[model samples]
Target chain A: MSTTLERPALRTSRKVPPSKDSRTLLKSQIRTGWALLAPALLHSGIFIVIPVVAVLVLSLTNYSFGDTWAWVGFGNYADLFGDVDFLASLWHTVLYAIVVIPISMAISLAVALGLNQKIRGLSFFRTAFYIPTVTATVAVATIWLWIYNPGSGLANGFLSLFGFAPNRWLADPATALPSLMVVGIWQGLGTKVIIYLAALQGVSRDLLESSEIDGANRWQKFANVTWPAIGPVQFFVLITSIVGTFQVFDLVYVMTQGGPGSETRVLVMDIYQNAFQDLKLGYASAETVIMMIVIALFIGVGRLLQKADAND
Target chain B: MRRGVGLTLLAAALSVLVSSCGNGVIEKSTDGVPPAEATGTLRVLLPSFPPSTKGKEAFQKVVDDFHKTYPKMKVEPDFATYKNLNEKMSTSIAAGIPYDVMVTGVGWVQPFASKNIFEDLGKYGVTPDVIKEKSTPALIPAVTYDKKLYAYPLIADARAVALRKSAFREAGLDPSKPPKSLAELKVAAEKLTKRDKNGNITRSGFDLASATGFRQSFTTFLASTGTPLYVGGEPNFDNKAGLDTLLWIKSMINNVQPYGQTNAAQQPLVLTGEAAMGIVNGGVDCSADGIGQKNCDDLEFFRFDSGKEIEYVGGDLASIGSRSRHKDAAWGFIQTLTKPTTLDAIAKLNKKIPAYKDASNSPQAKSNPLSQFVADGLVYAVNENEVPSNWLEMRGNFDIQLTQAVLGQKDPAKVLHNLAGQSR
Candidate 1:
């Protein structure tokens, strides 16, 4: 009786707590998250989503330089598939990607491994390797044109010393695409090497030392320990290089224009020439859509392979 | 070579100077009737440059005077580099924005005419009499499409061999008596060429292996051989004349190893003791920025070795755009620019012949040797495959075949057949 008088009478004004409402909570959570992510979503919708949708619509239509539009189903796609020049451009692009992706990755990985040894003048070496990436494509191509010129160019001048007939670097059909690939590999290697170098830092030093203490040879250690550690980085570089190679345009346009006769005419160049020069907007859109699908499928496959390797 | 063309053209051009200097107004009296109204602005576009900066300055003076004569109108000029002019024009026209006037090669006339991209001057006021009054009325047929004249004949240009006079003297060939035929040209080239030990070229007598060099030489050869670029709308490179042209170029490229060498490689070669001769644009005058001009005073020019040359004449021509709202103003501008007084002034400044036969030949045009060379070539020039749409494609194929032939991808006959097939 005395405790009751001291605590006073209990007033029950509040409603009872319900069971955890996951549905309601989820709805609220979604609201909160969407509010936070609205800007990025809006940006994607406006810039990427809208243009992509428009391209799809355009690809199916007879999009002319005319003020009005007339829709034509599958017309442009049919025309593009039939066009020989378009096919040639696509072939060149595929070849460029196939040769460049692996080579560039290997070069970058080699440089990364060497730099990972902590050599003297590491920064200088890094900058020296990366300098080509910073140069404008025009300047690079223009300078290379002179160098690759049949007569009085530095390349020919050097080749003369070896007593070998120096062939045209850009002019010759046999060498144009290969020469561009060399430039592409050089441009890409710097960024990739840096990325691998960063990834190498994350590998635990203790693990490497432990392997060394077990009397494992350097090659064995690298195969077992270093390779596994940088597997993710290698996957990243390979996928990106593939994508970059697929989108090759400026170098082809500036250097050879897919020339010595369609030897260097890459896919993006076809898209540009057809879309702009030829005014086949609908056809160009179809080509773009096809390119996107190809890149996506390839990337998906690349990711699957990475996962399989990890599991192994 | 480039120097020979430069020198000979210079001489031909100067012959006019002594023949035609009027103290006041030198034009022969004509029934000048294109009564132009005095108001509004007119516009013109061009890809090829007029002869000289001096000519441009003179043209401006004439424009100003024309403005004073009819103070209500103003005419403006525009220029575009040759590289992207076609694409630029295409996009502009597609957008329905057209310049009032343009100056381009005759190759462009037919395509635009077919498209009706240009306004019909005949629809406005051009009559048969006006065409008859003009010099080289024969050229009117070249501008005719669907039996109608689409453009006024401007200047005609052709490919000619240019060489350095001093180099000719040095090479022990008489500068005054240069090569009269292609065989003689090769002989001069062999004599003039110098080489280093280990079979390296020190100085090329001429650029032989280049696709452009080969094509120009090919055209000269074809004209001399009496073969047109086409026969009944089909390429005729399989013909005897065409074969000869192709073989001639192929042999030259094979002979001249390590073909290209300097910036002003061809003409400057003759001047700098590097080359004796070169084939280049036929006009006798040097470019204004002076690629081959600093020593151009001693350069020479020559007609291609034909029994009678069927010159490959090319140059800029002006046309009024169909969409132009200022038709009257445009016509007024054309009248002013092509008038005898203004034409004379322009010819004097340009060191080039005016497109107008009498107007260009009047005392002022005769004042310069380069202008006279331009004038001389006008009568004999021929244009076969220079229409815009077809010509662009033709040029691409020509370059391809020429390059393939030079690069040894295919023999001359094969290259010719391939080029001819592309038109279909």
Candidate 2:
């Protein structure tokens, strides 16, 4: 009986210290929180939820742009499996992402580590690196077009200085996809570098000092101390980078146009051709559905990895 | 603290997302009155022409003249480049706020008409007979679908060969008598081709594998070669003429380095004396009005003897939107622009051949010798039927296969065979 009485007293002391006015204050705080979140929630519902639902509905029907529509019931999705062009595009997109993500992240992280050092003109270097991220994609693509010109472009001109013959950078089927990969890496490096730089700055100096005292080499120190400290950022960067690379359309469009016999064609470009050029909205919606599933799978795997890292 | 920043960033992102998604706003007209009795503003869309200020001024002047006829109504003009016109029309129609009247490409009539996005001009007194009388017979089928006319022919375009006389003289070839047969053309090309010490072609004899990709030029070649592209609603490129044309293209491709040149390299090649001859659209002015007077002074049109004398005819067309509230006003506006004098002025300013026969034979058009050639060529020119809904996709597929063959990636016979199989 005495033990039970003590438990009750403990429970009361922990929970019941509020008056009516305090309870009112708590309720108002909850209301304020919801009010602050309302605009974003509404926007997401309108844009994200509605469009996703519409695409899902459209995937089940032959929904052209105007009033004509019919319930096809899995017909579009079934047809996609038999589409040789769509399959080829899917394969190309995967290959592109596979090549671009690792190379892009590695280079960006390397540059970010270099920029994070106690070096002179650090701000200028960071600004210079970030300039490409701010430049319009069209402008960048146009400049690169001139640079890739075999006869008079800067790329061939540079190769000529080393006694090498000119190369058709964007024209040859064998080289076009890889050439675009290089452009993708170059254009994407800036944002990743900036993000990694911020994450690196947040790394604890005391941890680095202790690791150094342990007589760890630079690579070992980075592997043990810096990388673990920025582990979450690395996962975030990898996820975003993969997603960005999977949706690459502009560079492929401006440079190769999926040319030399569709060697450089990717998923998004294929979707565009079907949707706009061919006016196959129903078919395009189905393609978009496939893209959404791919992106979801990628993000799902990233989340699983993120949870696994947390467990570790 | 980090949570607060994350939410703030999320809010910003959501705002951008909402801004980018379309709102699905539609036209607000609920009036039951027929467009003929209604009075309102009319909108007209035209293609970006000549890429010059004078070209824009000429178009605006025509709009201003149309506005002069209707004092109570206003004419609003919008512009889009030829490359983007189809997308603009499709999006506008989808949004239900398409312009009252707009310029359309010859190939786009099918898609627009099939969707009922364009007004059937037959309902408004413009019939097939009217089109046959006013426009070339080749253009009659271009704007008609399901025996209903959807658009009025506006400008005319055809393919022709332009030769550099100076290069011919340098190659010890006569400029006046150009090659009439494929054999003669190949011989002349061989004689005129120039090579550097490295064995690289410095000056090409003929720019058949142009940097613009080979589709447009290939179509012109096919027509001139008397190859049937289509027969009984089927792609029929597996015949003798087709095979011969492919082999000819392959032979041309082997003589020079292909695919490294810029998109507009052909015109500049002729201008700068890097290519002796180039095939170009009839509307292109390489003379005093274009590249330079001196470079094009000796530029003469060559007639390829395909034995059938066939040429590719394509052009911009004009049509009223089906959903337009002021359809009558739009028709009136279209009529005003298509008038003989207005059409003549547009053609003169833009250096294009007028669609109407009277406009083509006008005093101003007669003064330009090239315009006469364009008009004459329209008689024998033919256009593929624009009715097939999948024509664009079919054409795109054919272009890819042709490019593969031209680049030596695939055998021409195999490519054509595969293309035929796919078409079937």
Cα RMSD of all models vs. native, in order, equals 12.0, 5.5
Local accuracy of candidate 1 as per-residue lDDT tens digits, A3-98: 444666557768556557976898899999999999999988765665577677778875533333577898887877876567877788778888
Q: Which candidate should be chosen as best, given lDDT against the real structure?
A: 2
Best TM-score goes to which candidate? Answer: 2
For candidate 1, give the lDDT of residue B274.
Answer: 55
Candidate 2 local lDDT, A238-285, one digit each (tens): 888877877788788777778767778888888777665666666777
lDDT of 2 by residue, B1-424 (tens): 1122222222323332343365433434424554434456676777824547877777777767766666556666777776566556555554445688888776677666777778899878888788778866678777877778889987776656667898889889999998866768778888878887766677778766356356565556666766646543366666777778777877886484355454444353554566677565654454565766676576777666666676677777899888787777777778888887777766666556778865457644575555666667777776554436456566667667787887788888888787776662
Docking class of 2: acceptable
Candidate 1 CAPRI level? incorrect
DockQ numbers for every candidate? 0.11, 0.28
